[model samples]
Target: MTGFCNMVIISLFNWIYILSFFVVYTADAGVQNHHVDKQNNSKRLLMDENYYTIMSRLDNLTKEVEALKKENALLRHSPIAFLAELTKTVSGQNHQIHFDQVKVNIGNAYYPSHGNFIASVNGLYQFSITACSTANHYVVLELTVNTSVVGKVLAGDTGYDECSSKTFLIQLSSGDDVFVQHKSQGDYLLSASAYGFPSFSGVLLRAL
Candidate 1:
């Protein structure tokens, strides 16, 4: 820009010199020279505008990069993960239903022995379950978060084979427990398969 301004100053001095020397020149020639100068001035103005536009765009790109970096940092510390199952059967009454098979246990939140998931961070979570039972046997499954029943599903209601599945989302605090439990008494079994057909799953949807 400094160079451009210097050139403009030189051009202005030269134009003054031309005007003084061309005073005795034909009127038509003088008019043509002035028109040419106007065109060059317009072109320079356009170039200056383009330079500012480019600088503005560059600054916007820098800001976007910074925002992406912050988002990535948040994800690194985000308490978000999922746990699912494929095979294992649960049965009985008023007990935590265990999924013998685990497909995804993000952060190792789910424990097979205790049949529950302990949240590692405070966040919103999504839970789902599909419990299957044999003929004439209906199993009531309750989705619980720290002894509070948030959702429920029932299987074995369908004649030959029964499958009950549901998905819901909830907010949880760190160290909170999440699990599916058998609601009713009697001989009822939940079917889990190696193919992961009937299962329970939960995921940390977002960090609080």
Candidate 2:
């Protein structure tokens, strides 16, 4: 009976040891599985963050490109330049007149000459003129465009009353010419001025 009892106790001990070993192995496997799952989740989160960053960068680049395109278009369509031409005529000793600072040179002394002042763009032109005489002088001023007379002014009073200025709103073409003429037969001291060419700065962009 004693021998039988000892044999039973040893059998029970061996069974408990085997069960404990299996439980430990199972716990270790579970732990390894949890660690692998955590690692996978971490990798996925990093990938999502990187993808968002890349998309944001691409969006910003696209906006910049669009803005550049608009700027380029505006520059291409804007007007290029504006121009101004001026001339003056002074009375000689007798009834003779001399032309100075003629912006456009058309013909020689004999034939009826034509001169031009062109604006590079089509816009409202502010035409102006100022004239004065030392003595009682009679002067006829005629404004012309493309050789066609548009308006006229006469100055022949005793004092500064005859000194006058005129401004006109003129629509100009790319290569149009504006000119002034002395209509009266007698020679008179005269001076003329103009502004608005080569981009509204009173400078000529081209010679015509």
Candidate 3:
């Protein structure tokens, strides 16, 4: 009876040791799982932050591209340019020289009948004029902007035909008038095909 009781006590101790080992192993495994879950959460948060940053940058780039496209389209559609030539001899002082022969009037800003360039928009403009005079006759031409003289040129020689030219850059408002007129001096002009015809030309440099 004593031997049986001792064997029974030893068996119970072995079972207790095995149960304690299993409980320790299970607790360690739970700790490991919790650590892994924390690492995965950190990784997920970092990935989400990077994605949002990249998306914001891409959206700003798209907006900039759209603005550039609109500016390019506006520049392409609105163009102002014109060129005309004096077709016949002009006489008289203070006369408005009519460059009636149209060469390239892209914007229709130049009027051959009235000999004037009317501004369509407020802008900085460049204008040029070429004048030729008959032999022994001197001509002084003036470029006028709304009755204001902005430029002048004189063309004449002692026994030969002469030519002179002038260019001007001015700011203009919409509906402003620009034209070439003879100043006080000799007024006869030559119109020979051998020489280039007297010409008036203008272009819009920039919109105000």
TM-score against truth, every candidate: 0.58, 0.42, 0.64
- Per-residue CA lDDT of candidate 3, range 1-208, in tens? 9999999999999999999999999999999999999999999999999999999999999999999987676466577899999879887787888898999898889999999999998888999988898787888888999989998878888898888888889999999999998867786877767778999999998776
Which of candidates 1 and 3 is the stronger one according to TM-score?
3
Task: For residues 1-208, write the lDDT of model 1, one tens digit per residue.
Answer: 9999999999999999899777757676878899999999999999999999999999999999999887776577645555556355555676677776666766888887777888888778888888777777877778888879898777675468667688898898999988877766434765545323567778887775
Q: Pick the candidate with the highest lDDT.
A: 3
Which structure among the candidates has the greatest TM-score? 3
The candidates, ranked best first by TM-score, are: 3, 1, 2
lDDT of 2 by residue, 22-43 (tens): 9999999999999999999999
List the lowest-lDDT window of 10 residues for candidate 3.
Answer: 70-79
Q: What is the C-alpha lDDT of each candidate?
A: 0.76, 0.53, 0.88
- Ten-residue region with minimum lDDT total, candidate 1: 189-198
Clashing pairs in 3: none
Model 2, residue 115: C-alpha shift (Å): 20
